[model samples]
Target: MNMATNTPLTDEQSTEAAIQRAGKTAPRVTLMDIEAVVTSEFYFTASDGVFGASNYRPISDRSGVALGLLTFCVLVLRNGFTVTGESACASPENFDAQIGCDIARKNAREKVWALEGYLLKQRLHVVE
Candidate 1:
């Protein structure tokens, strides 16, 4: 009589195989990179909108825009927004400070779509 048997690989061996496979493949762009691009574009847009057509007190507008950008960045970063990326809208805490929760939610939804479009046009893919 002949019997077929299966043997399981050790964890160390499986890990080593995964590492080797990873090393041989081209580095893939991650969702984090897409998030960074979105963040940059958001700030750039805000800055340009504030200063692009201003002649009087351009400095004041620039300063206000900068402060707003920094506040947004700090809020997002400190609150673990990057980990959720475009899904931050689903969290109530994200808009807890806003005067109108409904408006905040709507804006967040729009932002996700806009950011996704920007990333797609830039040839960036979000890793699942």
Candidate 2:
């Protein structure tokens, strides 16, 4: 996890520290931290689309798309109004599944942003 050196809200850090002390395990990973990594990578790669060479295969009704790689399976849903992402992996011993889901959702949201821009221009008759 490429986490930032600066801590987040004091309350979050306190809670995480408490959880770690109680469990005697590695520092807990928060969803916010995971999203930060995903967003960072999204811009780091200059938005060449998320998940390199990963393609989206539409499911029935074209409401969702599935991406399968190695031991991971990610599902992204875009229904013209909302977007959602979820992932599952063969191994339950790690955080790959959750990270995959986060990346997938970020990828779908970028696509939606592009669509929104296009629609805006269409409505306003703005040239590209």
Candidate 3:
């Protein structure tokens, strides 16, 4: 006939009671609310790779470094060649006849030079 003896509140109930008491006595932020705010502004976008919208396109498949160097040259000579700022290095079609072939050849030469330097260093550091 005694409800208290029949079913006593478990530790969880005691914990909840303590929490409610603390809530009433003090103003405090919960950990869960802090976590929610921390995670709210997080994001993921598909354009995170090297060839993202921020980078140049028509990039060389052989070497990304070479492509980046070529893109730099394209940007530098763009104004003189009448290629617009927005179109610089982003679109090959924007490259004027004077700059297109020269840019491509320069990029290829840069790649070759880099490879040669790497090979020279390797040879210099041979164990024997």
CA lDDT of each prediction against the hidden true structure? 0.39, 0.42, 0.39
Best candidate according to lDDT = 2
Q: What is the C-alpha RMSD of each candidate to the true structure, in Å?
A: 16.1, 16.2, 25.5
Segments of candidate 3 deviating more than 4 angstroms: 1-94
**Candidate 2 lDDT score at position 42:** 20
Ranking 1 against 2 by lDDT, winner: 2
| Clashing residue pairs in candidate 3 (N, C-alpha, C atoms within 3 angstroms) | none
Which residue pairs show collisions in model 1? none
What are the per-model numbers of colliding residue pairs? 0, 0, 0
lDDT of 2 by residue, 1-128 (tens): 21576545455457666776788663334535333333222211211233445543333332222223222222222332443333334443453544765565555555544555566567667543
lDDT of 1 at 86: 20
The CA-based lDDT of model 3 is what? 0.39
TM-score of each: 0.22, 0.30, 0.26
Candidate 3 C-alpha lDDT tens digits along 28-89: 33333222222112111112234576665545554553343333222222122212111124
How much is the lDDT of residue 88 in candidate 2? 38
